[model samples]
Target: MDALEARVHRQLERMRELADRMAAVRVRETSADGVVTAVVDGNGALVDLELSDGVAELSPTDFEQTLVSTAASAARRAFAERGALVTGFNEEAAEDG
Candidate 1:
C-alpha cells in the first residue's frame, strides 16, 4: 500500500524475472563411463540425452534407470545453482536496502 511496500514488490518481481531466466538455462551431466550424458533445463526438465553403444549394451532397465537418475541429478544441481544466484541477488538487494 505504501511506497516502501511497492518498492519491495518491484524488487521481488525483478528477482522472479531473474529466476525465470536462470531456470531457462541448460546443464549436462555424464555417466561414469562417459557413455551416457543427460541434458536438463534450468527447471530440471530432461531435454536430451546422449548414449553410446557401450551404454546401450547394458540391460535396458538398468541403463534407463541410470540415465533417468543422472538427468534428475543434473536438474537438481541446476536448481541448486539457481538458488545460489537468488541468494546472491537477495544479498545484493539487502546491501542496497
Candidate 2:
C-alpha cells in the first residue's frame, strides 16, 4: 500500500477497536442509602436496576425520584467514559497523522 493508503488502513483498525471498546462500556451507580442501583450501557440506556429492601421505606414519589436519579447518574458516567475513550482515540490518531 502507498503511504496514504497505509495510514488509512491503520485508522480503520483504530476505529474498529474504538467501536469495540465503546460497545463494552458499562457504568453502575447506586443511591447514597443503597436503596437503588442502576447500570447503563455506552449509549446511556439503562441495562439493569437493583433495589434494596430499604426502598420499602420510601414513598412512591421518593422511590421514583431516587430510581430516576440513580439511573441518570449511571448514564452520565457511561457517557463520560465513552467520551474519554473517543478523546484518547482521537489523540492517538492525531499523533499518528
Candidate 3:
C-alpha cells in the first residue's frame, strides 16, 4: 500500500480500538447517604441501579429526587470519561499526523 493508504488504515484501526474502549467504559456513583447507587455507560445511559434498605425510610419525593440525582451524577461521570478517551485519541492521532 502507498504511504497515504497506510496512514488511513492505521487511523481506521485506531478508531475501531477507540470504539471498543468506549464501549467498555462504565461509571458508578452513589448518593451521599448511601441509599442509592447508579451505573452508567460511556454514552450516559444508565446500566444499573441499586438501593439500600435505608431508602425505605425516605418519602416518595425524597426517594425520587435521590435516585434521579444519583443517576445523573453517574451519567455525568460517564460522559466525562468518554470525553477523556476521545481527547486522548485525538491527541494521539494528531501526533501521528
lDDT of 3 at 15: 99
- Rank candidates by TM-score, best first: 2, 3, 1
Count of steric clashes across candidates, in order = 0, 0, 0
Per-candidate RMSD vs. true structure?
A: 3.2, 1.1, 1.1
Model 1 whole-model lDDT (C-alpha atoms): 0.84
What overall lDDT goes with each candidate model? Answer: 0.84, 0.95, 0.93
lDDT of 2 by residue, 1-97 (tens): 5999989999999999999999999999999999999999999999998999999899999999999999999998999999999999999988997
Candidate 3 error regions (>4 Å)? none
Runs in model 2 lying further than 4 Å from the true structure: none
lDDT: worst 10-residue window of model 1: 17-26
* Candidate 1 local lDDT, 1-97, one digit each (tens): 6988998888988778887879677889998877779998878888898988797578989898888788888989888888877788888888868
Model 3 weakest 10-residue run by lDDT: 73-82
Q: Whose lDDT is greatest here?
A: 2
Please tell me which model should have the higher TM-score, number 1 or number 2. 2
